[model samples]
Target: MTEIPKAADADSVTEPASASTLLARYLHRQRETILDGQIAAGAHDDPDAVADMVVAARRARGALAAHRKTARTQPEVHRLIEELRWFGITVGSAHELRTQAAWLLAAADLLRPRYVRGPVRARISGYFADRTRPAWIAGRELLASPRFPAMVEDLMAEERLLRSTVVPGIDDVDNTAVLEALLERVRSRMRAVESARGEDTRDAAMHGLRKAIRRTRYYLESVDDVAPARNAQACQGLAAVQDLLGGHQDAAVAKHHLMQIAREAENAGESTFTYGLLLQREIDRAAQYSAALPSAYWQALRGARVMADVHLGSAAE
Candidate 1:
């Protein structure tokens, strides 16, 4: 399981003097987190370290996106956002390969001995190990590249820019407006998911929804200083939606890999019956998560509504 970072101590730092300051602090903290993960990952093959780094990169990237309008005139800020995204995806690929293999293997293990046949476990392990080795190499190469250091520098520069400038809407004492805008994006994604008519389109839509949920959750954490309790509550609600969608994604990816493995087995004159069974299992797992999505999405939407209410209530008093 991926390790979640503990929330920072709210009392340890002074309340942000301005919205810009809050954003700046959030960016700085994420940078620190990424650096810490980088150091740990460099020291050893720690999956949790890679996960933390990817998550921190996502949070920093999402924060920039949440207030993107404020930096419309600054191309450098846009570059920073893109770099963070690139960094995250590149580093995350290795972690994904390993986790997906582990998930599928664990599922296969649950099958009775009679159902298992033809070196299924060994094939799965060897296939993933073959791909995972290259992925880890690429990830390590990225970390060592000058581009990585440049990205970190860009994060620092963006933080300084935010701290020095007044960003109008994003610089206000209350940032509920930004949160509302992000929630609207989430709703739009949900609508897209609902309207998707094809399997591929629906999967794409669900993936988009997952990204939106993560961005919203990270944004809420960024401004937790504003209303820690309400924001934390909202984050938890969004986590449900995010986690379910994540499972859906895992199943989808596993099914794809199983298909590839089955093709290889068929080419090698081995029966693909086991692979077919695993593929159907993944299909069923994805369906179950899909069936549960409506309730999870509702929980997220309700949490966002309640958070907005609390923000407005505080402003009124």
Candidate 2:
């Protein structure tokens, strides 16, 4: 059995390494994570395996994003990034629905017995289960697809290539510079959120900001060996921001689903009273997350600055 490495072990680097070397190590770790996930997912219908594979793909993609120049210069590596993106989306869709369903189910559980009227819980459960089934089937089909094996092979090939050879000017790729660029994008996304004119636009901007924050956090994690304490702090702060935004997004999605079910229930002449109550709770939850975004963003900004202050060696632009 190939056990997945611990987080600390994956990021620890005792000796100095080139920028290329650091990235290679990071990719290797991600590959191992994906392989471990595949094993676990096969033996058990583990959602955690899906989550692990998704996170690993995102981290590997983020690392390549951080090293923009290298990714641009290496056509094969660029292709790998695209494939990883597709893999993450395809492999994780079913899991995402299940996650939302689980949270919504718990929220429904919190409703008072008197308010829970007329098969509302059953409807909600059934609705999500119905939606999840097709996605789950598709995901399983994808695993058995040729594309899945191709992605695995690509990852292996890239890792070996990275380890054996450093691309031209890859040594000049500065961790600080890459992180700065990522943080700057986050800042820009925050500004977009602020300047968003309508509800839909604002929602999109907020989602974009959440993605930027997550990418920044993953990039920092890739370079954790350079300055473990600072990187950890930075990643922790960004995670807070990402998670807060994630909560809002989840509530939003849950509300959307709830509304759809409520409409269907109305057509069927069922009481939509419970759905109204549930919607209110999700609304309040989303509002709380929105209100907390500012402080979280500030904390993340501070941590990123501290982490970027370290001299992690740089590749020339």
Candidate 3:
């Protein structure tokens, strides 16, 4: 289980116990904020419910206000403290915390201490803590959840976001880092598949394509925000390639699922020609998908004006 970083990790500065207690309360309060929203919405038109809702609504808002103190307990707010130090990100109030949980997690990973120079680490860490944090968190969650159709849509949207944002920001040094990350993600997922075998191994390998596609989408979208805009059409074209591949993966998985159902039927002595035919259709789909994939996205990505934009004052204009 992922540990929720304690606010104390963000600061050595002494805090009032009252403050910590208040923050704890806030988490419980907002944890079911959606449920409260529904209740509040329903109560608005009920004369008898209005009084009760008013009290509940106030309590909810107050809970949020209290949690808004101290950034480190929640990942997003802690990044604003700009202290990569476990002791530096302690947030003091809701006003101090600006980002969300996903950003905080990503930023924490981004700021993992390294042998690199301190200022460089700080800057790179800042990138994840701020600009790309939400996407990183959400993308990781999406990648981990292997629903094929959703992954396909997410992969495509990620591609578009890159063309519009990520590639527009980066430095020459970081551009190399970007390419390395993209390649590494792809290779890592591919390796996951290569290392496994049997029905399980094949399933894992198929899942690797999902992971690769998502990571590729993230790196492209992320770094694009840091580099000068190139030809957007090129980016869209890359997305098209991923789309073809995604369709293949989806069909393959669906066909496999159908086969499982068919096998169960066969155990009872039923014919499964329909399931077999579905599997064939998926196989055909995969072949077509692989055929449509472009050679460019598959090649190593490099040579952008990485530092020409998105470094705050680093925009090359």
Candidate 4:
């Protein structure tokens, strides 16, 4: 569970690291060691694994640079990388790189799931769901992350205690029990919201979906939990439709509450009707999200990627 650093903490740091710091310095250390530099500092039990991570990291860095420089979707693509390397540090190791790399790859899949699927998604997704990732780079002294300072650490830690994982819906096969539990939770949530869809329910559904998106985004690079590519476009489209409905839903909440207050005071219910109009519009918008009958993200991840990562002193495939 990687933490979210606060904006204030970033401001307090004395010297802000430029985006190039990791590439120019940290990754350089690993690459120089592996790709024909001096001997490694330690007697590596699994130098090959370390070497593979280094190679992967190098590839990711290269891909990111090229993607950002030439890809038509530079802003969105780069922003994802920027997120993966928010601490201004790119782990020169594989799990670290892939954990981060998988984020963009998976998102690209999700956003474009309707059109295609390949190394751009599935293989990357397989890397994502592999559970042994996070532990790998945790051992690297070079992986110091300023991404999450103390306060955010505590906040996230607390959250984990209350909730098993940020995204209980994560596609971790080993966590089948948790996955099933999460399914139940989602089913329950859907049922609750479906029943309450008229006014208050719509707002709640929007908020829940918003939370889901944020949680999914968080793991974009932290682990191999890549959302599948085949369902990307559908998910994005659903989100798109949901966004419009959300606007209407929010307005409905405000107006409905305000109008209720007015009616209670013997005022006309006219204003309430305005809110009802917005709410009904949201009802219409929601139809689009459900129109195509797209499957959940796990269906996509299975064909494309999985969720997991870790290990440093000795690594694995």
Candidate 5:
């Protein structure tokens, strides 16, 4: 575990003590999670380890994003952000494949006892086994990549810089201003989702909405100190919205994978019946989630507005 740097004492602070303390703690936690995640990924212990690493990677990414909003003025910070973004993209591919494998496995298990016979079950098992090999290979390649170690080194160096940098005007910026800025971002993302809905690519649009909801939720969580109750409620609302959209996206991805598997099965002269059946199930699941999306989106928007009016108003006073 990475040691959190000792924060400057409140008595010695030249700015608002509470704000500075919160910022320090957030950055420290971020650094620790990122380091821990890298360590876990490199261990290559078990299949479960991949999921744990992915969770840590996401938390670290969210923390980096939250911190960058205020720290982007520094050139080093800007470069680190871009590097981490690429790093995330690289690892995320493996994560996606792992997720799809899990989804397909669950679907196969669900159909095994009743619908699928021994032959079909064996084929499904074979398909998933082949699919997982590439994910594992990609993960190993990522760990061995020079960029992984470089990112860890850069993060540590940035931590040192954070400890020395005196954040100016911390006392001048009210919590309300922060909340308002975040709320505006949430609204903008909602509009983006709406616009995406009008585009020809529905799957991409739904994926974009899921990302927006995730970012909004992370931003809300980062500001829990500003207004604990309101932030917590808003986070819950956004999370619910995120879950709904995430399910839709997952179904779509699973359907695509199933289609590919069906094609491979046909090429191999194996029965594609089971794959076709699972594909139809995913289609239904996707449709079900899509039908629920409009209501969930509006509810989230209304909740966001209520939070803004209540919390932002209180902060102003």
Candidate 6:
């Protein structure tokens, strides 16, 4: 079992500040990180740098979405959020390709001595290496595009605006409502997962579950100071579940890529045995992840229930 953080004594109470203040600070910090990531990516052609940029951008986007309700009435805030969405999509495409390429290459290297032999290892590595270039090219093109710099400038302007403007709903210093809202989001996502679980095409469903778990974890972390210690514990549980599902999704994607490679290898009269073996490994791994999902889901569900109890108890008080 994952160890959740122990809750502080209920007697020791700290009144959290207004959500607007917290959100402004968060946006400032995240914007700096995003800018730093972009600068670093521009300075180097390293895939790891690009990956870091993607991760930072994603974090910023998540933070934006988490507090979006408070700022929905502000056109500037809405515009910034929309821009972040497009930025995420652009970087996410490149990141996915690069990630898949890296995974395939690593898989080949790891299995070379045990399963793959001779020219097959080289072929597999080369195929993945070739695939990585296009992704890098795409990423570079996006980075160099005029809109990239414009977005950065726009974000800075919006951050200034956010600092000046007071979000209407977030003026209430009491964060009980915020925590309640986050709990509701968790429940909604959990319900979606339950409905999607019964569907035949579960890949997409599992992905959605993984995303929900991630968002829940992020939300918990953001309001950690305001929420009870149990929220932190719930975050730990959700993190564990997210990792399991994320690995499963990665395997599924790798298997799909391997299948395409296998067909290409066959068409070129090259040995497809290595691709088949790799594909089988991915399939087996995905199955193992699937088998483990029930336990993880139950753990997360329990955490959610506890959180709901906490929220309701606070309301009663």
TM-score on alpha carbons, each prediction? 0.90, 0.89, 0.37, 0.29, 0.76, 0.77
lDDT of 4 by residue, 144-164 (tens): 344323322433232232233
lDDT of 6 by residue, 9-88 (tens): 22213423345545555555556666666666767765456565565555555655665455476666667667776776
Model 6 is weakest, by summed lDDT over 10 consecutive residues, at: 1-10
lDDT of 3: 0.37
Q: Assess candidate 2 and give its TM-score to the true structure.
A: 0.89
lDDT of each: 0.82, 0.79, 0.37, 0.35, 0.63, 0.66
Model 2, C-alpha of 57: deviation from truth (Å): 1.4
The candidate that wins on lDDT is 1
Task: Supply the TM-score for candidate 1.
Answer: 0.90
Question: To one decimal, what is the Cα RMSD in angstroms of model 6 from the true structure?
Answer: 7.7
Q: Which stretches of candidate 2 lie over 4 Å from their true place?
A: 1-16, 46-48, 312-317
Q: After superposition, how far is residue 251 of candidate 6 from its true place, in Å?
A: 0.8
Residue by residue across 54-75, what tens digits does model 1's lDDT show? 9889999987787756546567
Q: Clash pairs of candidate 5?
A: none
lDDT of 3 at 18: 30
- Give one clash count per candidate, in the order shown: 0, 5, 30, 23, 0, 0
Q: Give the TM-score ranking, best first.
A: 1, 2, 6, 5, 3, 4
| Ranking, lDDT, top scorer first | 1, 2, 6, 5, 3, 4
Per-residue error at 254 for model 3, in Å?
1.3
